[model samples]
Target: MNLKTKLFGEVYQFGSVKEVLAKANEEKSGDKLAGIAAENALERIAAKEVLSQLTIADLRNNPVVDYDEDEVTRVIQDAVNEKIYNEVKNWTIADLREYIIGLDTGDLELKRISRGLTSEVIAGVTKLMSTLDLVHTAKKLEITATCNTTIGKKGTLATRLQPNHTTDDIEGIELSLYEGLSYGMGDAVLGLNPVDDSIDSVSRIYTLFDEVKNKWEIPTQTCVLAHVTTVMECIKRGVPVDLVFQSIAGSQKGNEAFGFNDKIIEEAYELALKEGTAFGPNVMYFETGQGSELSSDAHHGADQLVMEARCYGYAKKYNPYLVNTVVGFIGPEYLYNSKQVIRAGLEDHFMGKLTGISMGVDICHTNHMKTDANDLEILATLLGAAEVNYVIGVPGGDDIMLNYQTPSYQDDATLRSLFNRHPIKEFEEWMEKMGLIENGKYTERFGDASIFFGK
Candidate 1:
């Protein structure tokens, strides 16, 4: 089948799904986004085709995924269908397909993440290692991938600004940012979930942050997670719109609910390029998860992981700056347990990286999941090792407003210690000069841990 090139917008055809994406990854010149768009388009069409191979009977017969056996390697080796052999390969036909698709997407970073994840699955079923012991080994997988790098640039600790719901007044805004920056968590852009869709609320948060930024000289951009329409209004009203925020869904219909279609997305992107700072060329920020489609009943029967990857395809069109996969927040419907959540998180991070978008995660869970800080920590450590761009640094890992638990500044420190990663160089230099971080080391004396500012 033929698809339009993301760079030149020309139609190109590959005889098979594998060839389509394989060719795309090989093109390394001209506009890089075009190469990325080609890879994304490859995954989009490839996933749809892979999903078609499974019959109701096949899925029903293989419903239980946590079951362990070495049959996957056997199934991949034995499958005579050229399609399965070429584009699919391990745990079940579905997992096997996705694992291979991620590896094939021509992004070495994703391949590394997938390599780690599938190893755990294979070892679990193969009696090679107990699933309970599927820790640390995933850290062995590595890659040399780079994006515009929002919070944690490549090979460094990642950080972000998640100030509750960002419904605070100017004073509150300044204080919260001071707290995070004091802890060296401002390398990533400052992002907030606006309390409502009102353009006033959106403008107020942006204005407050901008004001605080100038007053305190905090080098960060701000995002009020208002609707795309609200952000568009902010742009027209001449308010500061640094990073365009929206909760994106896998299907077109799900996105339509938020007033974002191709036309609106393109328009918002063009506007942001002319306006936003601290990230783009592509300053749009998106939040996505696996169950969003099924939660909204727009999944169209595809697996949650693949469906979520499709959202990346949609996101690449606008060339987003940050796409956060809030892994465990959707409760137990799509990802039922920590195992599933961990796997899905890695898959989301992997797939997004493969599509050539600057990516990060909340590394979070809601009150309703079978996951917790321990589980989130395990995933965070591994994803950090995978060289993911960033994670949310909420105060003490508790979001009083969103009612979820995410990684804290302390956790960010642990990741930095574990991976030898610091914030991006600009922020890192600032930290060094301010004595928040001394000689590339974060000392306790940088700032008072409570109720005070640093630097």
Candidate 2:
């Protein structure tokens, strides 16, 4: 309840829990744009100092939005295991941070601790962690989910092969898809970000994905990243939908901005379970990013980091197979440059893992952002080191449709080899069976899209 701290012979007092959370965050353009960020470095540290002393119960009791007013807050609060919550309710934020990073802590204990944490507490502790701290703690946790294949195995990394075309050209998409698969990509899912989200266009793309998946007997899932409604309609029409995709937000208002409520998301999940084509209990794919709520004017005075973490809390209820933060796609207003982008990629991956979800990252940047391939490669290497469940793979790290740069097909292969990691076990075997790999290296057929055409 006390939001005051002394630093450098000055008293820094924040107005409320919201203010403290916002001020303690590392510099972000979105927070500055919102006019809620700390005015100076000393004030930022003061906020962190004050935030570290707050109790878990204090954060839980003061949900970012009133529980009655926001379904997101309700979902986060209602999901907390009360017994587990009680065990850590009195722990200070600093204590929670050290406990997580402590030498004695490992995957199982972290999972247990995750169940008791609200998204606010997660954000609070994250604000106090250094970049390496995020990586070290995240690397210690193992979170995996099964759709067609299990992902996030300790020695494995995965990629979502995004074969997007500027004009929804099936041939172009096919060419890109074949190229990506030849490089041993698409173990997570052969998902496309359609230039067209219409029913006809979306359905046609899904049909293509289905046919290719069946024809090659690829040991992976497929999807078109259309809106949830269009995807639900496709499923209702008996289209092959291995996974349901949606871009979700942290607050109910923000979700509304995305044109969905919990009801729609629940309906989509139920429909996928009853009618979709995946093999598992996990079949949802969610995308979240920092600054989305602020962009939509739905942040409700909370920092983007807290809002981002709430996204994980909301996604947790549905048990998504893939939940990736499109880390740098929201432009420089939210993430600014390379340093902030890399920091957010690590933060999101770490938070998603701690929230008990299979998390990935789209290590990306837009054209106008002060970033380039070098920055993205640095981030990809860091996430690779953190043992992320997956990262997005486009043909050349450029989504012609979305107009952003992500990891390329070659980048994914290099990451796996560099880390001595493999794709999902089944996909790896399939690649081996197809002679795409030998002696743990790509064979002569690698990068040849023509191979899938039997030429």
Clashes of each: 7, 0
List the candidates' TM-scores in order.
0.69, 0.99
Error of 1 at 420 (Å): 0.5
Query: Per-residue lDDT for 345-418 in model 1, tens only?
Result: 77666666544567787788877777878999888877876677778888888887788889887778778878
RMSD of each: 13.6, 0.8
Q: Which stretches of candidate 2 lie above 4 Å from their native place? A: none
Which window of 10 residues has the lowest lDDT sum in candidate 2?
A: 97-106
Measured with C-alpha atoms, the lDDT of residue 117 in candidate 2 is: 95
TM accuracy, model 2 = 0.99
